[model samples]
Target: MARYVEIDDVRVALAEPVEVPPRAFVGRDKELQLCRVAWGISSDGTELVDSSAPPLNFRLEGAPGLGKNEIVYEIARRLDMPLYIVQGHEEFTPEDLALLLTPDPEAVYGEVPPLTLRASPLATALYEGGLCFFDEINRVPDRALSPLASVLDGRQYIYSAMTGMNIGPRDSAARKRFRFCCALNPSLSNEGHVLPEYIEQRTLPVIEIDHPPFEDVHEIIRTSLSPSPDFLVAFTDWYYEQERQDISVRQAVALMNYAMNYEQHVGGQKTKIFDQVASFVVGRRS
Candidate 1:
């Protein structure tokens, strides 16, 4: 069900937060702590006492599939906050970041205006004091990101020219609780995908994320698929033998998952299935 909140004499329909997947999250202790500290969240999962200082907006810079999103999800889980996500792209506009106006389905005939104001995930998070994670933020162009400057800074509000409304938390408490984070592939920070200088300056404390260590990757695969020790041994050998470049956590998990599926449904011999899975994941060995 959609809920509405009145902001600046307009009824803004609140956007629901994306449901966090109930999956086993492993590793990234230091990166997770950096995010927590940026949000002013204590080690024990409580908000810090310094309400005077607003939380810093942080950015996760990494390659795609490196568990950047997972780190944010873990922080949200620990804080027990509603997480709203905005998937960045070239076409995202300023209005898309704040308010989206549409026709009202339930407006009475000649009684109320047909146009309805709908809040974006970012706006909803700002209003509700939740966490908003903008994924692949580098994909958004410079012109589309103008509104974020004020929101990222101490001003802490986004103004919508379409609705003529300033949308954000009205009180200090909600401002203290509101948090924003974004992730991007560092390789994309060139050509049309480069972040604006203002955005770069405001999204403080860039947290660089590389691929996890081999031990953590092993645990991640084990946790995701629960493969036998023999299967893992085979995987370890293959992993090093390839001397794979930029192998992400997602690819590692997918390798085991595809192997499991082959075992269950394809009725293949174990060794052959493992080889096929490896080829599918990392390309055939030269």
Candidate 2:
């Protein structure tokens, strides 16, 4: 169920954060440290030297499936805050970033106002001081992202014309706690989906992430797959030795998951299982 909060005299349903079960997170220590530094968070989890300055908003640039979202999730988990995510798309509008009007389920037909305002994830984060991540930000049309200027800047708020309201932190504490981050593929820059200069300017200290090393990948697979197969070592070695395009962490996980399922079904020999998974998962016919 969605929770409701009163913002500027208007009742708005807060957007729920993305939820996933706790899992062992592997590697990306450098990237995680970079994000922590950018956010003014210290090694001990305390706000750094200047508590008065609001945390800087940063953008994570990486290829698809490279654990960009996982980085954000890890940060939110460490901070123990709600993580509101707004998935970017080509058709997003300014209003979509702030508020939307939906038919009121409880309103009496033809008697009371038929519409209720719901806060978007970003707006809910702003109002409630939660962490908000805009994924694949480059996919959102430039026009739809115009409203983010104020929200990302020192002003630290967004004005919604629909309700004629300025939605932001309710108090100093909320302002201090509120944080924002975004992720997008830099490759999209050449594909007519480049970020606006102002946006690029406001979202500072851009963090560039690449695929994790093989050792980390091995750890990820070992940790993610419970009671990992004994042949996992052979499979990882084969994957690294193959002269094929590098797969993202997600693809690697998927491959291992398929291999586990295959093992369960066939109860095959180790070598055969590896061959089948490699052939099916990576399109390499053994």
Candidate 3:
């Protein structure tokens, strides 16, 4: 059944957790464990004290299309909590965080009903007490992101000026399980943001995701594209040969997808299609 809560007599639906299909999710066992630790999982499988170990709010910094989003999703999948995602953009605002609309009492002949607030993904994540992921966080303007300062720290509450109601710090059973993380994509961060220093200080121990090893990269590509063994070998060989190591797993997958399309539409040799995408698409990215 779908869960809900009452706030100021307004009924609000809680975010629900969705399951991901079990696929050959090629590597990152180490990072996965690290994320688990951040989210309050201990080596011996016991919940640590909050006073000594405050709740972990992670900041994932990496290039665009580097599987940062996937990493968090995997964390949520493991934790078995509702994953609420907020995509940061130039236009993101505090209003966007909590969308509130009052009932038009005059429009209706009967008595006015309670004012239910339409919560944003952030609010939903906070209210529901799950993993809240902010994708491309740096793209959100400072003014829009300022309200988050209260929620990231000891306060853990976002008071929506529009709604005149508190949105977070899940007081229910889910409070203990709530976690938050945000990703900063340097390549795609065209819109600048003055993210508060307080927020940075609050979300401790920043994690950096770099290029994966050859075997893991190949595995990632194989699972993503399912190319033939021969094609996989050639593609990996060519990929590693390049002096620049900027190509991420996501980029490699895109290149292969384009190669497959090229082979389908243009009717080239199977191997040559891979080569064309490498030279054109991958080369341009590099």
Top lDDT model: 1
Against the correct fold, how does model 2 do in TM-score? Answer: 0.90
Candidate 2 lDDT by residue in tens digits, 192-234: 8998999989898899989788878777878887535566875
Candidate of highest TM-score: 1
Model 2, which residues run further than 4 Å from truth?
A: 46-50, 105-113, 227-229, 283-286
On residues 49-75, what C-alpha lDDT tens digit does candidate 1 reach at each position? 465676789999998888999888877
The number of clashing residue pairs in model 1 is 0
lDDT of 3 by residue, 208-246 (tens): 887877678778878877887767766766666554467
Task: Score candidate 1 by lDDT.
Answer: 0.84
Model 2 lDDT, residue 38, Cα: 78
Q: How displaced is residue 268 in candidate 2, in Å?
A: 3.9
Candidate 1: residue 238 Cα off by (Å) = 1.3
Per-model CA lDDT versus the true structure: 0.84, 0.82, 0.70
Candidate 1 least-lDDT 10 residues = 44-53
**Residue 280 of model 2, lDDT score:** 68
- What's the candidate order when arranged by decreasing lDDT? 1, 2, 3
The CA-based lDDT of model 3 is what? Answer: 0.70
Number of the candidate with higher lDDT, 1 or 2: 1
Q: Which portions of model 1 miss their true places by more than 4 Å? A: 46-51, 103-114, 267-272, 284-286
